[model samples]
Target: MAKPFKNLRDKMSPQAQNASEEKAKKMLSEMPLQELRKARQLSQKNIAEVLSTEQANISRLEQRTDMYISTLRSYIEAMGGQLDIIARFPDGEVHISQFKEIESLQNSKSAQSSG
Candidate 1:
């Protein structure tokens, strides 16, 4: 025995329904990692395939409290996204470039070793 789901919007006035719809849209836009992936029409399997990892690892990655920038960048890039780091202060915000520095450092080290 299961109860049927009702359309709550149907009971609302037109204006109220419109407002509710807008709120719902905003909330969806601010969803967490798992919801964002689903909203993008992707599954953990899809992400795992792109990252060359197992589905369980993707789930664990999403649940992690903190992760390395390189690891996060790999996950985001696999999802067709570019990761950006920003710093915000009372004055304003600034885009951090340390992530790029990691690449530059590696490149310089390799060049030195090769030369």
Candidate 2:
């Protein structure tokens, strides 16, 4: 009684198929932090352990709409991902390098403090 989705999709025009694929790609590209974490197969406890914080803190951080860049960077790093700050313009997009520099500085400071 039910048709397979792949068979239905095959009946679509090439343009329609391409549009559907593009929409799916867009959906996969953007997601909230909570969804991203789950997609990466990580739990709040896992991130907390890597970040040296409590699980409650990780939960609170994921719910906030606003947070410091360093805080966000640390959270993303704990999940084994690098955070990139991108500035989109009418002409093109630019990747902001200042945050990368900040991360390097923090790493150096941490190394010095530990050693």
Candidate 3:
């Protein structure tokens, strides 16, 4: 008879356990944009209305492998979620601000006005 599936997590080392947990978290958090939209139970027509576009446009957008950040941001916001850009290096990961340039301009204006 075939052996039944075994839960090997109990026998894993602490480091292995941590690594597994991290992998699980990453898998749960990330997926294709179309999958994310469908998982939210949103229709293409619904997203099109939010973006003031046609359903066909939304459909085409989902099929695309590349798109502008603004387009992605708008689509994500339509699905009631925020998009974050991350930079990963050997040392660590950095969450890049979406509006850094705009924020910097505002900060500069504030400093100028205060001066």
Best by TM-score: 2
The 0-to-1 C-alpha lDDT of every candidate, in the order given, reads: 0.85, 0.94, 0.86
lDDT of 3 at 82: 75
- Candidate 1: tens digits of C-alpha lDDT, residues 66-115: 98998888787888988889999999999999888996787799899999
Better of 1 and 3 by lDDT: 3
lDDT of 3 by residue, 1-115 (tens): 6644345777788999999999988976888878888889999999999999999999999999999876887899899987778899999999988565655677799899999
Model 1, residue pairs in steric clash: none
TM-score of decoy 1: 0.68
lDDT of 1 at 59: 99
* Residue-by-residue lDDT tens digits, candidate 2, 76-95: 88889888899999999999
Q: Estimate each model's TM-score.
A: 0.68, 0.85, 0.64
**In candidate 3, residue 68 scores what lDDT?**
82
lDDT value for model 1: 0.85
Better candidate number, 1 or 2, judged by TM-score: 2
